[model samples]
Target: MRGLNKVTLIGNLGKDPEVQVLEGNVAVAKFSLATAETYRDKSGQPHTSTDWHSIVLWRGLAELAQAYLRKGSLIYLEGKLKARHYDDAAGVRHYVTEVVGEQLLLLDKKTGDALPPAT
Candidate 1:
């Protein structure tokens, strides 16, 4: 059986998405998402924690993100996890994992924009 690699996230954008156009006019967008969780400790004290994740979108989804998404925009993202390794200009090797966004939904009331499912 084939292994499954999928991820789903509901969070707010940490910053405006960075957009780039490749040689063939293909668009790509990259951004950070912040997800928060609340919990109660044994003493009944409530605490909140936040996690930040890197997100990547391609093609149509990338365009949509660039046009509508911005800092603090709430969204639902469905995608797969991808790990990549690269060497920086300083000759330092770096490994990073990011969510490759395939489907996106704008959950904020202001935009009310929800993109169609990814192809």
Candidate 2:
């Protein structure tokens, strides 16, 4: 059986999406998202933790993100985790894990216009 690699997150954008076009005219958008969790311990102490995740969207999804999403915008992202490795100028190899988003939903409420459908 093939293994499964999936991730789902509901978080706030840490910054605006950075869109770039590749040599093949492929659009790629990158951004950071922060998810916070709060809990109370047995001793009546409250604890809160925030985790930061790197998110990447390609093609049409990238375009949508660029148009609508902004810093501090709440969003729901569904995707898979991907790890990439590359060598830097110093000849050192580095590995980074990123969430490759396939589906995105804007959760922020709009004032005048209706939100776009999920892509």
Candidate 3:
């Protein structure tokens, strides 16, 4: 019995990826992506809403993100949703939900000329 936890998103990076080298020399990158929607309200007034999501990429994907992705860069990401909780130094517990990216595609060819082509 398998339950699916997949997530797919096409959005712009809110900021440059923060990369870190962990134990075993593994690379990890963390960043935020912004997805926006524009809609008309019941009164026919147009409004725009933006949602921010945290994203995590590891190993090769992390390296690629660090190398190419930047703030406001459009990208396609496919991954799984992951939720975790951690206690801070002040003894407060924080819950976080993030996407653990497995596949990444740079979608802004106009601004991504330096990036490798999407495969």
Question: In order, what is each prediction's RMSD in angstroms?
Answer: 1.4, 1.3, 1.8
Please, what is the TM-score per model? 0.93, 0.93, 0.92
Give the per-residue lDDT digits (tens) of candidate 2, residues 1-119. 99999899999999999999998999999999999999999998999999999999999999988988899999999999999999999999999999999999898886455556666
* Candidate 1 collision pairs: none
1-119: candidate 1 lDDT, tens digit per residue: 89999899999999999999998999999999999999999999999999999999999999999888899999999999999999999999999999999899888887655555553
What number of backbone clashes does candidate 2 have, counting pairs of residues 3 or more apart or in separate chains? Answer: 0
RMSD of 2: 1.3
Query: How does model 1 fare in lDDT?
Result: 0.93
lDDT of 3: 0.92
Clashes of each: 0, 0, 0
* lDDT of model 1, residue 8: 91
lDDT of each: 0.93, 0.93, 0.92
Best by TM-score: 1
Error of 1 at 104 (Å): 0.2
Worst 10 residues of 1 by lDDT: 110-119
Worst 10 residues of 2 by lDDT: 110-119
Residue range 33-110, candidate 3, lDDT tens digits: 999999999999999999999999999999999888989999999999999999999999999999999888899878
